[model samples]
Target: MNGRGVITQICIIGAGPAGLLLGHLLRAEGIDCVVLERHTPDYVLGRIRAGVLERVTVDLMERLGLDARLKAEGLVHDGFNLTDGERLIRIDIAGLTGQHVTVYGQTELTRDLMDARHGRGLEVVYEAADVALHDIESDAPFVTYLKDGVQHRVDARIIVGCDGFHGPSRKAIPVSVGKEYEREYPFGWLGILADVPPCNHELIYANHARGFALASQRSETRSRYYIDVPLTERVEDWPDERIWDELAIRLGPQAAAHITRGPSIEKSIAPLRSYVFAPMRHGSLLLCGDAAHIVPPTGAKGLNLAASDVHYAAEALTAFFRRGDNDAIPAYSDRALARVWKAERFSWSLTRLMHRFPEDGPFERAMQVAELDYIASSRAAQTSIAENYVGLPV
Candidate 1:
């Protein structure tokens, strides 16, 4: 569309949910853009799993005409259970605040988005595409990438780095203005997917002296579960019997026996951590989603936070592209950081409440239990959790 042979006005890197959803939104607005992904569509669609989504995200998908697939397949969780060895306390999210979380994996969301993008006849380059970004201060920021063993360069009015934490977009920003804050927890989550029905009707967050265990469902016949373990532990070290024994101990005596384990479709240790980079922008290049920040999965804010960030970026970019106003660009960091900090606080609080800290004494453990009890008993506290868990309004 330009003299430089750039086919689109914007080029988006990474076809993850954030990138794909942003592409969908921009396409609906008749904006021209292309998406580049590092993994094949099948791999991207099969590997990632994110079980929590806020009401705002679901509403946005519905408004954007992207909810049909989600509605037909997604599981709506109206409540969550908190257990401390013997007693089980359930917090009804919908009853508390008229909001609920939808159990949809990030991979599934990516699949749906890719389907939508393909249906619209949009282009998405996948598998080992190398992207080189240039001209952050100029009106036209060119993206050079390789496709099919051939080098290609495309010039665009703007470039969006929706790639995740491991992608190259974040490194493109000059290190002088960017400061990354990170913390790696001593523990990681051993996530597993089984073909059995859920052990509980709702999500169960069980805290025991052994560790933290989460029992959640993906579908009627499939369940998703997690157990906290040392960061250095390997999946191979956790045999089937060991995995089940840990789950049973943490889930307490009420868990159904003989719950079948599927082919261990997914197994990995997700290292817990919190990361944030200030100013999220340098000149015209902007970062969103995991490219900007990362949070421990304890609060289930990773995917939703990414969606919120991109939504804000879309709004800002729309204003600039249409009216030539630079106000939004300058305020991008502050605007996004506000929501980022709130998520950070919630994530850390949840992590603290559930996990056993190395330095935590009896008093701290008692305080954690008391906090959990307070949340379960107090309507005000439950409402606060519901509002955040179901997602805050964008």
Candidate 2:
């Protein structure tokens, strides 16, 4: 280490999937990089998140030769259902779009990346404290953090923030330089995870008069379900039985009949929000994943979106470092944001179609019903949903 800092070609903040995946990708190309995380390894893997994997994500893993366990364990979902409390309107994504989404847990995918770190020679410093970014607008950007009672610094040619929305990298950018777009929903998702079989082989997104519900699975033997609840409600207020009962009603009688209720392994209330920050890059600092944008979980795009960000970032960094391409660095923001806006739109539209807003009255409800009816009847509508559901090409 130099007197100033540990010098590297690239420095990545946040050891979440986005950061880890980018680290691995850079390493595979013989690039020197380091990742910093504010949390322990266990804490990072403990977070419960969406897992629908698009082709872009699958391709990256495959390209890295990291899909052995994923191929062996991931479930290939051909289609998913949308309902209006009466019947299911199945969108055959694979049939219509010739594409499929893999049902894999975010935790599991992170585990795969984590386990492969040592073999790939990727350095990830967990429990990094008070991480701060410096000179992002200048050619030489560096990161500093306190670890194990010693303050350390990392000087790099580039800094990528995969640290999520609340992380320091994004905040380091001058507020005047970036524009914020956000929509906070009136309700939140109350999700329960259990070690039981899913009610259905495929996902079911239901819009009942009572509320919105989604029945999903992490594996053949593990299920995850969610129901929209007023933001005022607390996890303590809804007991296991109460959540199960609500799921039964909102998911409709057909899905309810097959529900295998079990003790919740994890349960929480997550507020829904759609947020984006324009110009994902500011000088030497580049933002990826949640640091740049966020989407509601309605379309299961959160993790996949992060993966796509890493994909674009890895390519851009590789070009800059390997070929001395100055243009790729500046072009990264626009390329990543193009896909980000589309995913945000899809998630927002799906959330609007499925959730019952407190301000929604007869007209809004009728519009939702009409839209659902049109989607059910029209092949073109289903094709559009299928394309977005499986994800757009990167």
Candidate 3:
């Protein structure tokens, strides 16, 4: 195949939530763009991801004109549980924050974005191989990528690295221009998705002597559950029955009684980490989502954070193109980082407050109990937790 280069205003790498949403939003604003993904469409759809949507995420989807299916199919969760074996504390999101989170799988949301893109005949190059960035420091930046063993190029006014942690975009930014901050936990969450109905109406996060366990769901009948495991643990080591048994012990008797065990459709171990790359822009190339930061799953902030990044990027890029405004570009990085750090703090605080750290001693464990006790009894603490859970702002 012979290649003739394509040119556009914005060339986005990685068709994940951030890239696709930004692409769709830019199109709605009459900005020209294209998206590239290293994975095939089916592979992207099959990936299992969390679904607790902050009110802002829901609003963004509605603005994209993709909320019809989400509204009809998603579950509205007014509250979630935080437990310490002997007791459970439910933070009423609606009562305290005047907002309710919606439970809709990330897979479903991505599918909606994909469908919207296709309906508008937007281009997304799938299975892009060996993608690379060029001349990001100059006004004219471009992308070179391989597709079906053939080389192709996209020259654009701006390039976005919505690509992920391991993607080339951040690496393309010289280390001198950016600083990276990261923390890797000693344990990982071993999660599973099963077809059985969820045990409760809302998600449950339990802290026990053994470890942390969570009961979450994708839909009314499709359940998701996870248990914290040492870094040495493997999915092969956790048979279905063993996982169910451990979940019961950690969640204690009351929540365990409602458990419905079934064969898992998907299972994996995800290591926890908190990471942020500062100054998310390097000239014409900017980073978003995992390409810029990562939060532990404890606060369910990963996907929501990605959506917010897209929100900021879409607005900034639109203004830049429409009015020749240069301010929103640099401002986007600073503004997004402020919120990213707050989310990092929330995830870090929650992880420490709930999980049984390998190095935690008696006093550390007591701190967990004390904090949970206070949160359970104090309305102020509950409100604080509820506001963060529902998201702070844009």
Q: Tell me which of candidates 1 and 2 scores higher on lDDT.
A: 2
Best by lDDT: 2
- Model 3 TM-score, 2 decimals: 0.99
Off by over 4 Å in 2: 1-4
Worst lDDT 10-window in candidate 1: 1-10
For each candidate in turn, the TM-score is 0.94, 0.98, 0.99
For each candidate in the order shown, give its overall lDDT on alpha carbons. Answer: 0.82, 0.93, 0.92
lDDT of model 1 at position 143: 86
Clash pairs, model 3 backbone: none
Candidate 3, 108-155: lDDT as tens digits = 999999988878667899999999999999999999999887899999
Clashes of each: 0, 0, 0
Candidate 2 global TM-score? 0.98
